[model samples]
Each structure stands twice: as structure tokens, then as C-alpha cells.
Target: MEEPGPVHCLLFAEVTPPLIDSHCHLDAAEFDADRAAVAAAAVAAGLATIVIPAIERANFGAVASVCREFPGCVPAYGIHPMYVDRAEPADLDALRATLAREPAVAVGEIGLDRFVEPRDDGRQAFYFVEQLKIARDLGLPVILHVRRAIDPILKQLRRIGVAGGIAHAFNGSRQQADEFIKLGFVLGFGGAMTYPRAARIRELAATLPLEAIVLETDAPDIPPAWRVGARNAPDQLPRIAAELAALRNLPVADIITATTSNVCRALPRLAH
Candidate 1:
């Protein structure tokens, strides 16, 4: 009798490969209480991997520790725009060194955020531009935190291009989305798409090409409609992907497959 091949065994076992949460802050204080439980729950919920991005030099070690503690978690290092004011020029040097020392997947959680009050645009621009240069020099992709500053973010991206990465928690126009795609970036959709009232996000989730879309939780932040006013976690990703499937009128399996592939493509190191 012929022995079953590995593919046949997997099929017979009825195992579905796990999904990816392209961007998640698993190191956030919100998970400090039951971080292990949260990671275990995410694995049980079918998540294969989660990307944890550091918001500043201070959190770099925290992010690295989380990734070490959880085999499924990977890290990205950068100085978030909001923290740039508190950042020293030396921080950029630190970021460069950390990226070299650590096996980070991308350079990110970095970008402009005009939504903040008393915005220090100059300081933000300096840090953002410098980090972008670091990413470019290292030939690494970036994970962006673009909010209301999409146009300005795009301008800087154009000025200093890096390897393709993700526009994390993307909430921009179709034109802006297209621009990101043109630059070898994929758009990240998550809890925001689960809300019916988020018409623009829902519309984009429905219409964007599957190949250009990735899924993220932005967890402990953008809770889905069902979890409104509550904490979000990586375990919520499967349902979020299901919501995306509903939006696009596609099978949940298809959404899972395509999005998992999209994220791996966006952050090639994840494929390892």
C-alpha cells in the first residue's frame, strides 16, 4: 500500500494553516496581566504569527523581550512620530544599531500623525525622515502608522523610498491606498472594517484587491464592533478576517489564505 504523502496527511487531519496578524502590539501593557494566556489564545484561535512594533527607543527592549518569550511574535523597531518630541538625535543611531543587532522584520510603527494636538511637525519630520533613511539603507521594509497625515507621509515616502512594507491601520482614500500599492506596500485592515458605520473602511475592505490587503488587529486599540469599548487582542483576528470575507463577498478560507500570503509578502522575513 502506498504511504500517504504529507499533503494527504494534512488534508486527512483536517488542519487549516494558521493566519497572520501583520501588526499587533502584543507587548502593550494591556496584555501584561495575562500575556501568555493572550498569546496562547491567539494560537488556539488559529493565528500563526503576530508582528509587534516598538513605538520608541524606550520600548525597544520590551518589544524584543515579547518576541523572545513568544516564538510566534516578531519585532520591529522605530520611533513613533508622537514620541519624536521626547527623542534625542542619538535615538536614531540607537534604532540603526538595534535593527542591526536584532532580527527585526521591519522598521516601523513610524510615521507622521497630524491628529495629535500641539503637533511638532518639524521634529516629527526629522525623526520620520531619518528612520526612513535607515530602512532604505538597510534594505528593509517599513511598518507605517499613518493617521490623518497620509499625504505628508506619501510625500516623504516618495522622497526616500525603502523596500515595500505595510501601511498599518490604514484609513486613507482609495487614491492614497493605490499610491501605497504602487510603492510596493500593502494596506492593513482590521477591527475598523468590522464596523458598519465605518463606511469608507468597509468599502475599501470590500473593493481593494485581495493581493494588496493584509490583516492587523492594532489590538488593545481598534476593537471590532462586537467588542466596542473593550480591549482587543490577537485572538480576535480570525473573526476580523471573517468580517473582511463578508465585506468582500468571498469565502472566509480565501480571505485567510490571501491575507496570510499578503502579509508574508509585505514582511518577507516573516516567511522564514
Candidate 2:
């Protein structure tokens, strides 16, 4: 009986469930020096999966290579809007062929970006529409990189509907959030939501139905408040999850479970 007392403690030991970094540029140049260590750290930090998206046709090989090195890492192949200037029409064909040849989860890091200066609206539209068509034809979801262009993104989505995907680093209004969710998309919330001044984003994170929200780091990009101006990584996700839990006034475990399920539902291939 005396020894039996300590055994009960084992049953109650706190265990954190695995998390998914829905979007992370682990293959980006920022990680070139320590990619292997970063991947290992993510696993040790309890990351079950990390989705790495390609920004252009040239990097498709890089993305695939990263995924090959890290089994837990998955790839989403697409030409990002920012890089569309350098993209040739033939790259679209390459994108199509690559998606067919590779185990790509989605056509992404794709969408509009009005924030950039001296951009060709027509060029962005051309690439966006073509990529949307590719996603539609391939019957794959897309990972959107929307910036001041959610409405246009929604318009095209309505026109050439594809399988639902995640709106990475979503900073749209509640109405926009509803629209994406209605279209079978889950909005990604990450480092931006952790900031006190990101009120609109924080409000959305707290108020949006848990099922419509997914977690992402957008690593080497949107670093959390504590790590602002530093290189972000997938290992920061658990803390991001905790921030979401605090925002929603729910337990961290609940946030993790709901967001993980949301991601799987958004990208069904990841469930495998």
C-alpha cells in the first residue's frame, strides 16, 4: 500500500500532445546553416508536423529535399505572389508538372500581395488565376499568402473553387474570416496573434470558432512578441498555442486539439 501511493502520480503526469506548425519556411536560406538541428529541435519540442511551402519554381527542389531529410516536414508547391515578377509563363507548366510528380500537399504560398510597391496588378492576377486553375484541376487545396488582397482572393476562389486550404497569417476582418471559413478554409494564427497591439488579430483568434482556426509559425518570418526581430522557428509553436489558449480563455490542450484537427481537415493529405 505504501509503494502504491507513488504509482498514482505517474497517471497524472502532465503530457503535452503533439503540435503542427502549419506553415514554416524551414527550407529558407535562414535555416541553411542549421536545418538539420532545427528539424531535430522541432521534433524534440513536440512538433508532430511542419508544412514547408515553396515560394517559386526554382525552390521546389529545395522544398522537396527538405521534406526528404525531415520525414515530419511536408511540402506545398506554388509560386508566391511576391516572386511572380520573376516567374515566366512556363513556370506555371512546371508548377503543374511538379505537383503531379511530387507529394505536394497544396498549391501555395500563392495569392495576391498589394503591399509591395511598383507591383504589376495584372501580373499578380495572371499568376494567381492560373495557379488557382491548377489547384482546381489537380483537386488540391491551396495555401494562400494574402496581403491587402483577401477580397480579390475570395473573388477568384468563388470563380475557380478548389479544395479548401489554410489562409496563412490571416489578418483580415471578421467578415473575411467568415468568408474563408464558408469556403472551407481555415485561417492561420501565429506570432501576430501573440502581440498586444495586434488587437484585430487577437480579437479574431479569441472569437472565431475554434474549428475555423489553425496554428502556424510562418517561421523565419512572423516571430512572436518575445522573439520579435529574431529568426522564428517551429519550436516556438507550443508557446504560440498557449497564447491562443489564453486569448480564447480555454485550456492549452483544447486549443492544441482543435487547431490540429482544423489543419487536418483543411489539408486532408496531412492526416496520412
Candidate 3:
């Protein structure tokens, strides 16, 4: 008899292989209580890797430390838009200097966020454009944090070109999705797709070419529907991938294979 593959997906009867949580914050305080155990459990849950991106100057060291502490975690460095208000010019210098020293898989968890009130569009644009340039200059892929600012984020990505990367938790239109693809980027779909009410996201996941899609947990955020209103983690990635597989009417194995490939292509350094 053929050996049964790993069974991590609740609804995806198709066997699964090791998965990659393309975006997660394993360094977040939510896991500080038992971060090591969480990392071990995620590996046991069938997750082979987790990409952790730093949100600000403060956590740069912490993110890097997490990577050293856990073989399964990789790091990305950048300034998140939500933190630009408290950021200083010197921080950009710090980011550049840090990237010089660290082996980051990408430069990110960075981009525009129109969702916040009292929006400082100029400051946001400045930090975003600058960070994009740093990523470009470093020849590193970027992990974008695009919210209601997709078009604007796309515009800047076009202006300040960098190696292709993942558009984390992408919730844009199919047209926008195509635009990202044209630029050699992959769309990340996660916990949001698990919600039946997220019709638009479901439709995109169902219809987009699998080559253009990647899996992510956006952990400690974007909790899946089954685990709604609860803390999300890297271990939730398999079920999250299963949701996408179900959305596309494909087997979990196919989703796992294609998405894992997509992520490696998006962030080449992570492939190793």
C-alpha cells in the first residue's frame, strides 16, 4: 500500500508535506511566555519554516535573536508603517546598518497603511520609499504590509524597484493581483481566506494561478475562522493552507507544493 502522507489539514483529506508560514511574528510578546515550545509545536504541526519580520528599530535585535534561537525561523528587517510616527531619521540609518550585518531573508513587514487615523501620508511615503530603496540596493526581496493602501503601495514598488517579494495578506482586487504578478511578486493569502464572508479573498484564492500564490499565517493576527477571536500562531498555518486548498477546490498537497515553491521563489534566501 502507498504510505499515507502527513495529515495536518482538517478538511483537506489530501496528504500534506512540510509547510512554510511565509509571514509570522514568533518574536511577538504573545509567544514570549513559551516561545521555544511554540516553535517546537509548530514544527510538529508540520510547519518546516516561519519567516519573522521586524516591525521597528526596537525589535531588530529581538527578531535576529529569535532566528538564532530557532532553526525554523528566518528574519526580515524593516520599519512597519504603523510605527513611522515614532520613528526617527536615524532609524533608517540603523535599518541600513543592521541589514549590513544580518543575514535577512528579506526587508519588510513594511509599507503603507491607510487604515490608521491622522494619516501622515508624506511621512509614510518617505519611510516606505526609502525602505524600498534600501531593499532594492541590498538586492533583497521585501515582505510588504499593504492594507487599504494597495494602489499607493504598488505605485511606490513600481517607482523604487526591488527583487520580487510577497504581498503579505494580500486583499486587493484581481486586477491589482495581476499587477503584482507582472512585477514578479507573489500574493500571500492567509487567515482571511478561511472566513466564508470574505467572498472577495475567497474568489481570488479560488481563481488565481497557483504559481502566483503563497501561504502565510500573519500570526498573532489574521486568525483563521475556526480559531476566530483567538491568538494566531505559526502552527495554525496548515489549517490556513487547507482553507485555501478548499477555496480553490484543490488538494492540500497541491497547495502545499505550489505555495512552498512560490515562497522560495519570492524570497530566494529562504529556500536554503
Candidate 4:
């Protein structure tokens, strides 16, 4: 009778599975009010790692701070093409100083963008070439932000002779993809593939070799189908991974393992 009087029920907690968000921008102003919460949400949603790429010289500190604050967040530094006009000559020197001081996992968010007309292609080229040199000298891989400038970017990469990097948000022809793979780069797929209208991209994802593919969400930016027009986050990676899995005709677990392994190999610094 005493035991029956003290009977209690315990609730079972649902465990979330873990995944890597290989690319994201946790330092952006969009997350200022709730950065800690946002990061926690990502972790709660099973994002085990995040790679935050620096967009300008000014954001390097913030990017580094976010990495330090989060256990699995890694930082990469470079000048984004759209911000080329705002970049100062000394910014490159500043970048070099910062690189020497902080030592990021890669050099990036750097590359050309021909989509915006009247943009100074020369300025973009100068900064890109310099960053590539920095990456080469440091023996670090890069996170490329190429758009409508893949041909020229490829030319520069070939000229620099540095091996491997991630072609983030890749949307190019099969031939172009092959060229990047030949340079040891891995093609990154993201929410774009989840769109029904993105037939070519989905086809590319399916045709690309499993070993050369990586998954990303480009968080706070490229939200997947269900999240279109909403703020994207690292938590969306699982959904994106499922899209990639479907495209490649593989199971979700296999896609996760292959893409995570490919990311680790491409970005050795993230291994820590």
C-alpha cells in the first residue's frame, strides 16, 4: 500500500540528431538581438558545427568572437565581392595582420560576381588574387562565393595553383563542375536544390560524385523550400541534407556521413 501511494510517471525526452552546418553567418546583424539563442536553436536542432565566413575587414573581430563563443563554430576571413568598393587598400594589410594573429580555418567568402553590372571587376579581381595568395601562403583552403564569374574564378585558381576549397552554393554546368573538381574543390549544395524549379541544380547534384559533394544551408540567407522568405538558420541543414540525399539517390545517413566527411577533408581546420 505504501509503494502504490508513491507511484510516479517519467516523461521521455525526444533526442535531436546531430549534423554539421558547414557554412553560415552567425555574426551578421540579423542575429544581433538573439545570437546566443539562435546558436542554441541551431544546436538544439542538431547543428554540430558552423563555419562563419567573414564578409569584410570590419567583421573579422565579430566573426572570431562568435567562433570563440560557440564550441563548434569555425571562422574564415575574406572580402566579399559586393563590398569591394567599401574596402580600403589597408584592409588587405589589416586582413594579413588578422590572419597572422587569429589564424582562421580558411580564406573566404571571396570571389567574383558578374551579376551586378557596373561593379568594378578590377577591384574584385585584385582582392580575390590577394586573398588567394594569402590562402596559398598559409596553406589554407578557401570558401569561394562565385556567381556568374566561375570561368574567371577558375582561371585565377588555376593561376594561383592552390588545391581544393568549397564552391559554396554551386549553380553551374556539368563541365564547369568538372573543372572545379579537377582543382580538388568540392561543390556545395544547399536549399536551392530543394526548389522544384531548380531542375538543373538538382540534376547537377544527382550527377556529381558523392565524394565531391558537400551540404550547406548558407544560414540566415538561403532558406530551404519550407523556409522560403523566412530567416534561414543552421537548423535547416537536416532538411537540406534530405534534399541532397533524394537528389543523389542515397539514404539520409549516407549523405550526412559523406558530406560531413568531405567538409572535414576540405576544411581541415574545422576538424578541431
Stretches of candidate 2 above 4 Å error?
A: 1-16
Could you tell which candidate, 2 or 4, scores higher by TM-score? Answer: 2
lDDT of 4 by residue, 58-113 (tens): 89999999978876687789999989999998998888777767747678899999
lDDT of each: 0.88, 0.89, 0.86, 0.82
Clashing pairs in 4: 220-232
Candidate 2 per-residue lDDT over residues 1-272, each given as its tens digit: 11111111111112356588889999999999999888888877778888889999999999999988888888889999999999999999999888877777889989999899989999999999999999999889999999999999999999999999999999999999999999999999999999999999999999999999999999999999999899999999999999999999999999998887788888877763
Model 4's alpha-carbon lDDT is 0.82
TM-score of 1: 0.94
Q: Which parts of model 4 are misplaced by more than 4 Å?
A: 1-18
C-alpha root-mean-square deviation, each candidate: 6.3, 8.8, 6.9, 10.2
Give me the displacement of residue 160 in model 3, in angstroms.
1.2
Best model number under lDDT: 2
TM-score of 2: 0.94
lDDT-superior candidate, 2 or 4? 2
In model 3, residue pairs whose N, Cα or C atoms come closer than 3 Å (at least 3 residues apart or on different chains), thus clashing, are none
